[model samples]
Target: MDRKIMSLGKSSLVVSLPKEWMQLNDVKKGETVSFNIQRDRSLVIYPSSIKKSEEKEIIINVTSNEEEILITQKILGAFLNGYTGIILTSDNIFTVPQTKAIRNMAGRLYMRVMEADAKKVYLQSLTDESKASLEQAIKRMHLISRSMCEGAFTALKNNDVALAKSTFSLDDDVDHFAFFIVRILRNAAQNPYLANELHIDPLDCMDHQMLVSRMEHASDYAADITRHIIMLSGANQTIPGEVIELMITAGTQVADLYVKSVEAFFSKDVDAAVGIMKCRNKLEKLDIEMTSKAFIGPQKEAELVCGICSIRDNIKRISHCTFSIAEIAVNRAFKII
Candidate 1:
């Protein structure tokens, strides 16, 4: 693993490549190699031929008894597994509903429906995983999810039904970015070339996956709060102003936690991660106060109380996600040091 630096001349220094690595890569004399500088200040040397490989392909055979939802699920799985080309075929013929489902599912993902017929349907991934940034997408995902929480609280405070309904649309944006990150991570796990291109190791991919999943879940919770808002929109009961302020305050704090934790994650700031933990204690204390106020509603205001309780719970879940991010950030920072 160690190579001595040798002087080629007064101006140049060189180190010999590892024999075992050269043999594994089928290196030959006069062949060129590409060297990439990593974020950790490490150099990676690889054969130029290994830069790109054939695209992965998958096929799904639809059966007569197979449900449309199950077929759509399988397509999603294949997409996450890094299959760029997907074929859906049926022994007899695709039903109208089945064809519709495949089309809809492909539309949902970053893939496009290339071709479709009674017996066969083709899907192609439009996203270039190599070009899609895993880290940047996750960072954006955190921002969007945090904003969803903030928007939900704002809508509740202003009694803006339209704004609450708009939050649900942002959920789709979260899914789009999350799906792209998941696909890239999955590909990076299976392909070393991709890992090199993405400048992330397999271990780092696993850590990122946890964050991506949490962000997805956080987005879902934000959307759930929006649903609760819509439900509470028509209710005549008035929520106490103090309780609403407390909810908004707690939600804003957790949103800030998300931003800080994610910043620590990429920057490897141990102190920032630790700060998130310190803030968590305060969030928990506020939760107790929010819970007691949640149960103080009368029968007429029970539905509104339920909405308030769900919003509080969603904010708590968002805070929990930030806690996980902070922990991961601490671990990653320690490893880096």
Candidate 2:
């Protein structure tokens, strides 16, 4: 992998390319190559033809009565592998459950059923990932998920089943962005040409993914909070007034902290992350207070106490996740300028 630098004239230097690399790229004498200077001052030299990589296409065979979950996983795998087009052919007609699973997964993955019949299904990815903006996508993703978290707390305070359902439905929207961003990151990490187009180095893919996962986790905990709200509402039960007040106060603070953590992450503001992290003790104190008060209501109503505790625990989890995001923000900042 080492190439010796040789003096070419009075003030120039040159290093020859590896023969194996040139042969693989079909580069011959008189051919041109492209050189890109990375953020770390490393040089990325490649043949001109490598500016664009060929898109992948795949076909998966579905066995008779194939597990619906397996089919969905395969479809997701194909999409993550950078396949622009996926064709699924079943040995026989797809069962109703199989078809339903495929349709649902398509919605989640941003793929559409372009062509479908009794035994064949064709899916096309919706967007050119290279052209998509990673920052904007991640921002939108965090924004939606943040709203989900906040709404979960709102639904809990109000004990509104309809509101909880609406908030729960937004998790799908979050996944849409999560899946799209992940697909883009995975593809860019593998294809340097695509990485160039995305304006992100390969290392960025791993960092962004970690942050995205925490965002997703925060939203998932929030969704759990809403589920507890919905169950309590359906059961005609509610939290103690004291517990409600404390839980809402704690949840709101956590949600606000989550928002600031994401902002710090995108801005790479280490000071802001440090400031946000300082608020963790407040969450711990609130958790302790919530635990004592959550058990004070309805001695015979064990369900009510359990549900209130569940909601409180979920809020605590959200705060923990938010703090982790702040920590990640501080780390991610150092990787940049």
C-alpha lDDT values of all predictions: 0.84, 0.86
Please provide TM-scores, in order, for all candidate models, with all chains considered together: 0.85, 0.91
> Over the full model, what C-alpha lDDT does candidate 2 score relative to the true structure?
0.86
Q: For model 2, how does the per-residue alpha-carbon lDDT over 57-95 read when each residue is reduced to its tens digit?
A: 899999987899999999999887789889999998999
Model 1 agreement with the true structure over 1-337: per-residue lDDT tens digits: 6889999988999998888888999998899998776556677677998766458899999996689999999999998998889999999998888888888888778688788778998999867777867777887888888788788878877877899999878998998788778888988887677787888887888889987888898889889878887887777655677788888889878877887888898898999999998898899989999888767755636687687778888889988988998999898887751
Identify the leading candidate in terms of TM-score.
2
Q: Candidate 1: which pairs clash?
A: none
Q: RMSD for each model, in Å, please? A: 3.5, 2.2
Q: Name the lDDT value of residue 58 in candidate 2.
A: 96
Candidate 1 has a TM-score of: 0.85
